[model samples]
Target chain A: MTKQNTKKLSLAPIPYFWDRDYTHQFYQQVAQSPIDIVYLGEVVCSKRRALSLQDWMTIGHDLQAAGKQVVLSTLSLVEAASELSVMTKICQQGDFMVEANDMSAVQLRTKFESNAFIAGSSLNIYNQRSLDKLKSLGLSRWVLPHEHNQQALHAFDLGNVELELPAWGRLSLAYSARCFTARTHNRSKDQCGFVCDQYPDGLAMKTQEQKDFLVINGIQTQSGTIQNHLEAINDDAVDILRITPQQNNCFEVIALFDQVRKQQLSVTDGQKQLTECTVHPISNGYWHQKAGKDWVA
Target chain B: MELVCPAGNLPSLKVAVKAGADAVYMGLQNATNARHFAGLNFTEKQMTQGIEFAQSRGCKVFLAVNTYPYCHDLPTWQQAVDTAAELKVDALILADMGVMDYACEKHPDLNIHLSVQGSATSAAAVNFFAEQFNIKRAVIPRVLSIKQVAHLVNNSLVPIEVFGFGSLCVMVEGRCLLSSYATGLGPNNHGACSPAEFVEWKNTDSHLETRLNGILIDQVAKDESVGYPVICKGRYQVNDQIGYAIEEPTSLNTLSILAELKAIGVAAVKVEGRQRSPAYVRQVTEVMRAAIDDCLTRPDKYVVKDSWNQTLGDLSEGQQTTLGAYYRNWQ
Candidate 1:
């Protein structure tokens, strides 16, 4: 494998519903971190109005001024026309790079900007041909889908676009029209009382055997375990490591990944530090092409 | 609106055609299609015969080459497309953008319909696919409400088709990774979710347990009726409650809202089971065809007949039918 010091660290957009103050405070800590890129915006639910576009832009400016590249991420599921309009506005901002999570976002970004955009992992890019097709539409970098295994990556001709992989945090598993968080509280989606804020890390779902299975965050369902690939940070395929924001010490998590990627700390020590910060167990089975919830290591 | 039915094999295709289906959709006996189950789908000779039989009876046959292919296996999907085009099927239902690009450039004359696995929920997404590949129609995912379906139909550049009667997928198609999280196989990568090989059934003294790859999916008393062990439909615990957290084991039956769907200008109604038997196809196709014809003929006097309901219920998963996301309350 080719070797270089090109590995960078990226902060994935917040997938949970954090209150305004908590959101601000989280970014305040992120600004002082050694992360290379900061992706800001609400990518999960449209009802999550804790941070508006202007609010995210203000934070983006702050992160940019702090020597971090800011990328605004669009919603993964674009259902309403209003959401499409918001996406259009974000794509046309021209101030920051936009991560196209859905195809509508990609179309809007391609229509507005000539420069390549970052294709988010939600785009379902499974093959080289799909990658080549996206490249024609001006894809600058592509995030591998969380389900993609090491063998799948080896076979894919990533071409010239940079590859980003999720290194830590809950793996987003499924999305539906029904708000699971609302359903959990026996409320309709239209009348949902923004109860997702009650569980900043998301409501845990367990199997019948009481095994922690999944987490419900509004309409998005995520893995119950944190997916950490810190040991694979030096893998040549990954150009960037994405650390998703969580409720706890995400700054420390980012620092741990940074140290491990820079080879300042051994992977074993980094994994131990990561385990201490996570609320649940850590899984790396996805990297080994096994069930995503399994810990192959 | 036209009625689109699924036919897993030649017998199913013949059954659907005999039952007055407007079109019968099937796939090759390979992993290129989404319903890549054992002892199902059609061979090349059977596909040619099925096409001839359907065309002779003024019915169309669509080939579903809908599964996403990775780099190493893309040639298999491309070969399926070439075979479908050479067999002179009515249309190719595709989901992958790469495969769509291939079909668009390789066989310009072949018709293309966006598969439900494409997950185009909004007008902008549909228009993007239409503009890029010139898809003739796009199937809407089962996640939209009836009002949303109407809005999409009014705004879509191409005609839209929605699921009418079949197994309901609670999660949006093309986006779910729950199966892969459990069994290491999923719709996008493996074309099947909660594959049969991973399923295990055990009977204890008091209850019957269903597991998927050693993960407990559901457990029911011995006297209770059992449903298919699909991962999403299984009972699970969320908060203090334990039940069908994701979705219940019910089939999506939109028969009661046929008039509303027809009024919204929905182009076609798609059935979901390609892994089902020929008997299931015949019964569902006949009932849906009768219902659609009756609704179209007398919209003012249309009523969902009890007989039709019984027929569908007898074949439905868990013996229950719901409007699914067509009604907001079901959401």
Candidate 2:
């Protein structure tokens, strides 16, 4: 086992909406976890008002007190003036690092502070040149988009900026203006009624053959299969492993990853534990440069 | 407002120009451009000919070098930009920041239009491109409503271009990875969505099944009309109901809202079909040109003619046309 103390585990901000109390409870549990970093705030639809800025700040303070790095994430798609306003406020918070999910957020961050920020996965950084360009714009760390293969990562000289890879959870495939969860219930986006809360992880979508395909979480669509790269935790390219928060066993998954990273458990044992905890099939094909749905194991 | 039409080849470019397109956008026959399909787009000689033909008719030619380049392939994208500049194309439509930076530094005088794939929905995002790369125009993503478009146009430092017609992408461009998830090819990395090679058509006893890289996208009866198995447009079992869960397979037709678009100070209207035939380009370009002309001539008298609607409807995907995200109801 590689004794690398640099490997850190981060909790990705919840992409779906849970009740405010549930979110608070989740973070309270996270505050006691072995996770190194916690990303707070919403990255999906703005309609999800489970937590306000003050709520997130309070949570951030708690995580900070718990000896964890807190990075506030901005929205993935900034279409409205209201969303842009929120993004600007988030970027100018100045207390914590901001994850610029959209270009607007990146622009706003660069405008407010020359200090480094994390470029979220939605900001398409396909190559080393693009990465270098973003680095020039004050990007300190970046999450690799789930679509990029490991071969692509190996080819790039990522420089000083830390590389964070999604180590667990469903891949956020796409986001749209229309709330798909609303559409599923034959309701308009304006009248979505926060139905995404019903499926805390996300609403599962299947093919005609009853094969699990996608999960619709309001406007965001994710893979039905949870991406588990616990076995590949020792990759030198990765500095941080991001585990997305889910409704169930999210903390256990984080603990398993932490144990694996610390050499307390074998990769196979970690995978077995993760499989036992997750309801969906596990996949690592995106890391293997194959179809995302394919499970190499 | 100007009408920007797409040209997959030299013939399509000529048809666009002759059919009244103010500008025709195309790409090189490589992954540097978004429409990097087999036997589509242009060669160097073909691009030169396309520019000459468009210029002869007092129309403009824009080269689309819009795809993101990996570190190993950065030189190819830079070369494409350099070649397009050398060819004296009217403009270069680009998406990636690195490529935009290269274009700005290497070819300072070349006009750069931010591609729709850049996903610049907000004015701040548009201004960022304009301020950094001196982008002259920006193609807005198809995710914004007309009200949102108006807000952006009001605040934008650069001129705004909107998708007036063609197939609608339910997700914001540059952000979508659904294609990549399903077929290992996407607009950002591979420059192709639902790549032709991954597409398979199977005819069962009762239905015609379309699959992309072995994931069943849609299955339809023999008599039912079928569209391409673009993952977003596919039917799926959502909430125990089977239908187009994401978006129905329909082409965007903003002809009805031409007057409103003009009033909102939109600099140009873009037609989004490069993989389409010259005939498709000609019909769409002609109808849009006529509609824009009529709308400009008399805004009060402007109305989407049934004939124009029928012409576009004939060429629409799935034999259906929609206002898409431009209409708030569609969202």
Candidate 3:
């Protein structure tokens, strides 16, 4: 079922808050890479204040010039009036395509005559009926829910609705406006003091086994293990390979995915390189219907 | 304060009303509402009739159109609002903005209470919905601590409803996809958890076990209850030591904290089971109503006791009750 020629790999926007200089540097390098599309903007708790809209626009333009199509991303956890207002403004922007991570954005996406926004995985899109409905609402493409298998994916009834699968990146598990990281630090949301920016990928939570089980990025706690589909990327069913940007060595991760996309690296070789380079282990159970942290080879 | 009870069907609605529930919330028997179950909810024809039945007994019937509408299905959502407005229920519990906007613009007279599905936890979020959608009340998310709810109510303009009794989620409300992470159907989209059709109970060993969509979910022991396949409340191994990796099987019990809830100025205490039996509705309603009454009568001696901890025996997957976000360190 592996498609000989896969849809090109894309770099999803950073889901955390990094320093402005670091943010500029990440995209500056992304501008020179082989990634197809780059998502820009914060998708976690609203307290990540390092990047402004103008800063996001600048990076979007820079990534576009670097030959990558940049889509502005709305925050997954929009908790306040200001966040909602910000979401409305972000969806209305004409220059860049928008990724509606939250349902509020979906409501605003249909406000205009256009229905071409990217639906984020957080939208809980699972069934063909749901997919068909979203397609009718003008969804250009949908990020498949993490727990889907080939049976579920192929079973999507509508032929027109496009599917984008997460080939790389730690699963964006859950979003909350309440920052667990801030609470862990004994601080309120307003007084969080930009603490989450310290950990680029996310703050890893280990079991008593001291095994890295989960990672907390502000209010959004993701799996500690990244999801790798180097093997599945060969399958024709994959319309988009989303490589989420982690805090460290993400450029190398993107390059490894590029090698797999180009067929230069075998799945075994890719797994070897991935194991060598990635500090954290990789899991694809989400695609296999086992466990979010299970590796199914 | 009002005690909002769940009515999965006509019998349950009547049971809740008879058991002293101030209000009963229900939905049109479809995926249009959050609790879209097989034997649950009312038909549109029955919904109209049920609203009248609740009214006859000095009880209010609120319609829940709380599921998020996808891109193309905005009209159906609009029509849902149109239908609810036409039905003239006391209120329409809403989660999505377009539906809220439709209710605000078309059914201007409708009292719009934000559904917990909306997950408005912050004063700012509550105020935002109040300002933009003109929402009259907010059902706060199951993430805010009691102090947090107090802070939120103090800062916001709208009346706030808190979960005084019901399903205590390990993860924050309106956020976690662990259920979807396991099964595929979840609250944000289909408004279900570990959908029954996807669940399978098999015999892996001596006793029969439960699986959600073919994944080995729970192993039942002799004399132990075989609960529903809820991702957050199942046992799993993190590093070889098997335990409840996601959440334990206990439902939230705030019966002991009802006085604290009343002191916090919460507008209503909501129970969390619409797909439950009429007996379940009556039982929970009687307990919560007693707790609220004790809060009003005794005042000083109104400490809600923890006796009715009723093992709820795997209620998270079916109809559940949680004290969501009212207490600290519930996990």
Candidate 4:
């Protein structure tokens, strides 16, 4: 059911590898936006060295100074020992609340006895008992997996845990050890030359019919069509609406969402404005229990 | 190291046991298991008979109720756990956290093996499951190189099991949603990927087209053979070129690395594909069994025979094989 007013807006970390100056400018815009929480980190390939952990911490501090709650997100796939070590440092940094993207991150947080952390969508918590199990291990909130539907959310008996939903940006569909961005260039992942920086958003993939199919950013694959859930911002089941960072017009998208959530704009008008913000097609099919590429309306 | 094999039906189970599989893993005829195919998997009666047949042959039986259950479907998964415990299978392979919690509480004595669908790629992730659910063994995803695999084996709190042969999952198992993005059903939630009902193959004047839920996945010349329409294996266009942008159709064959896996202290080597025929299971089990036995017998003199490699390659998808991510070069 649609509640008249939504609670909060969160900015998901930049899933791409952008230039340092470009990333700083993006955050400068985010600092002045109406985002309530800001997640900052290199959640995708750890090889993308455009930003270091200290760099993210600086951005976090700046966003915090701007009166936005900040979260440090760990990597979604931890395959290398070096990657695991990085995750351990994030879990133990003890500066900001951590978002555990993988079970390895969750284990380290529980072992270090961090008071409470956010469960990233990739944690694979599909049921209430699973959430409860993590709750016992110090979980305060969780971002629902993008594939989950409204019916699945209703089934979860979330006692006091807050729920966050992805409301905008390209959906991260899958991750692999093999980097597609490198493979597209016929280069191995180790010798990738950090070419992912060329596509600040992500490299688009199309079907044989030239239909938009997917986006490749190093090891992560995302939906070619951006997901716009502006209509669902008023969902009472959601405590926060997540807006992933894009290469352009992100704040305008955030402002439109902010207006919609505050009941300052109609859903129809908000969606119409959202279409002008990105060249990609928009989808809300996952929220309607259909294929993720479809738009219900 | 142990040689674990897949069995989709009672006949396949018997074939695997007779072919020298140390243990045979089978799934129930429901969405509780990953291979939720139309005509694949075991009914309750078939499961009881299969378990009895395997046990009588001195081969252990593992019940795989490995799919994640939605909260509304908790009772169905809980019932599966109860049935597995009552039947007294040697161990249960599970992926869902809630199902694992239920099995741990209801049948504390039952052994649990973390399924690859659990997506535990590191020591910390496996240890977390071991501490929380008391899982005796964990299967790592196929995304790790041999060096990384050795590192995890060295650090994991419990014994680790790695896939020996299978249709490789290019993406991490449990975290992937590409199939659902196209067809609205996936391995994690629906126990299937590129489900058969959504697949359609069309023959044209010049080429054969493969589609999943009406989206073109791959089109091959009339002379070229087309395998299943898994999204990762399909060709797509990126930039100016059209090719296998994700992955080519190939099966993972670790026959060359059998000795290395044993040397790394891996507990078992699992052969994937529960949807294969009994003939495929028989040949794969025989080859894997002999390979493991040879490796254990004389680690210094172990060499993969050309005939064994030829036999496995013939049975692979697309009649091709790859080292997959086990070798760093593949990554």
Better of 2 and 3 by DockQ: 2
Off by over 4 Å in 4: A1-6
Provide the clashing-pair count of each candidate structure: 0, 0, 14, 0
Instruction: Report the number of the highest-lDDT candidate.
Output: 4
- The CA lDDT at A171 in model 3 is 87
Specify the highest-DockQ model's number. Answer: 4
* Best-first order by lDDT: 4, 2, 1, 3
In candidate 1, the residue pairs with backbone N, CA or C atoms under 3 Å apart (3 or more residues apart, or in different chains) clash, namely none
Once fitted onto the true fold, the runs of candidate 2 whose alpha carbons sit more than 4 angstroms away are A1-3
TM-scores, each model vs. reference: 0.98, 0.98, 0.69, 0.99
**What lDDT is reached at residue A170 by model 2?**
89
CAPRI tier for the interface of model 3: incorrect
lDDT (10s digit) by residue, model 1, range B1-331: 9999999999999999999989999998877888989999999999999999999999999999988887888889999999999999999999999899999999999999999888888888898899889999999889888888888899899999999999999988989999989888888888899889999988999999999899899999998876768878989999878998878888999999999999999999999899999999999999999999998999999999999999999999888898877778666
- Candidate 2 residue lDDT tens string, B169-208: 9998888888888877788878899999999998989999
Model 3: share of native contacts present?
0.12
Candidate 1 global lDDT: 0.89
DockQ, ranked from best to worst: 4, 2, 1, 3
The TM-score-based order of candidates, best leading, equals 4, 2, 1, 3
DockQ category of candidate 1: medium
